[model samples]
Target: MATDLVRAFVREDLKKSDVVAEVVSLVTVLEQEDFRKLLQEFVDGIDQSMLLDVHLLNGLVQLIRNAPQGYIDVDDLVKILGLLNTRLKDTHKQSTRHTYQLALTISQVLDSMVDSQVKGLSREQLHEPLSDYLEELKQDQDPYLVYQATYAY
Candidate 1:
């Protein structure tokens, strides 16, 4: 419950940013089955406000970057992660450095989550997504992320 409250607080702060709504909207559309919207409709709407809220986005990213199965509040956690791949997918060098930085911060937080003791979560659910994101961080060119993943596993 504490973690949930903490996450909620973080989410509230993120929403205060000018871009959160746009980014969340894009992410929602990305999750949709319509293919035509993913590229045009989604990308056009995203902006720095949504992309640049470092703490809020990172908190959401870390919240779902890695998760355990059977956790009492698993669904709440997983929903947060939906952004890293979609909302943050536009990540790049000059364009999204800060966004990428936030993602990196999330990687660190995710590493901690992986290392932390978990209860009520299934190992499969936890490891799959976490490991996937670990690789994602690696691809993002943050080599240091490996150590955290090593500890987490």
Candidate 2:
């Protein structure tokens, strides 16, 4: 039921910003098990689509930002980071407006994690991949990618 609510919101023709806000609101009230299921569904959705929906990405960021300490464990963080890395690489060769949007959203998600100081997430685990991702983003010709990379740096 919780996952269905999220899917319904995602499928709605609402504005991207509105979709994100709605998802965030819904995510905040979900029980831990429900949240985990939603996250797994999100991972599966990305695996099948090979594209990260900006609304969903932003929603997840908000959830991370507002979640209680220890709500998101290390394993969950790993999955989220892995998904971000994959999307970054998958979109690297494409310089469309959508890809630029994805890059900016990715930056926001990363920023939220840092600002929240997510429990059970270690610097050692974050350092290498994040460094590599930023380095790659810095090399992009797109101004938005450069700005995001710089902001993240």
Candidate 3:
């Protein structure tokens, strides 16, 4: 039921700013239930190659962010981040901003996973993305963006 509801939300059309809050609420509820398998199945079924609309991706990021720490698999996070990176462009400013937000949230999530001593994600899995994202932040032309990215770390 949770998966179906979340998937429906992802499929439905939503106003730009509304997706994040709704998804965060849903994630919090799912976290209380410890719904790992449901999230895993949903994430695995998604096609990362396709261009995701910003609203949908924003909701996804929020979902991951608010979900219980270490509940979301590292592999799923990696795939979602890769898809988000592909969609990160200057053309859509809102999406780009949310993507940065996602990046920051991901850094926190990774830290929580490490602190909790979760297995399955190797140190390399955690470090590689951290380094790559840090590099990306450093190269960003916007000082504000770099600041946001670094502050997240």
Candidate that scores best on TM-score: 2
Model 3, 106-131: lDDT tens digits are 55545544554555544465446555
Q: Which window of 10 residues has the lowest lDDT sum in candidate 3?
A: 82-91
How far residue 10's Cα lies from its native spot in candidate 1, in Å, is 11
Clashing pairs in 1: 19-49, 19-50, 69-121, 69-122, 70-120, 70-121, 71-120
By lDDT, the best candidate is 2
Candidate 2 on 1-153: residue-level lDDT in tens? 666776675465443667557666776677776666656655555556644566666666677767666667756666677667667667746655655665665676666566656556446656566667678778878787788777765
Give the per-residue lDDT of model 1 (tens digit) for 1-153.
333333343354334444433343333223322222222222232233444555454434422333233321434333333344344445553444554554565455444445544335445655466566555555434444444334333
Worst 10 residues of 1 by lDDT: 34-43
Which rank order by lDDT, best down to worst?
Answer: 2, 3, 1
- Candidate 3 steric clashes: 0
What lDDT does each candidate get? 0.40, 0.65, 0.53
What's the CA error at residue 108 for candidate 2, in Å? 3.5
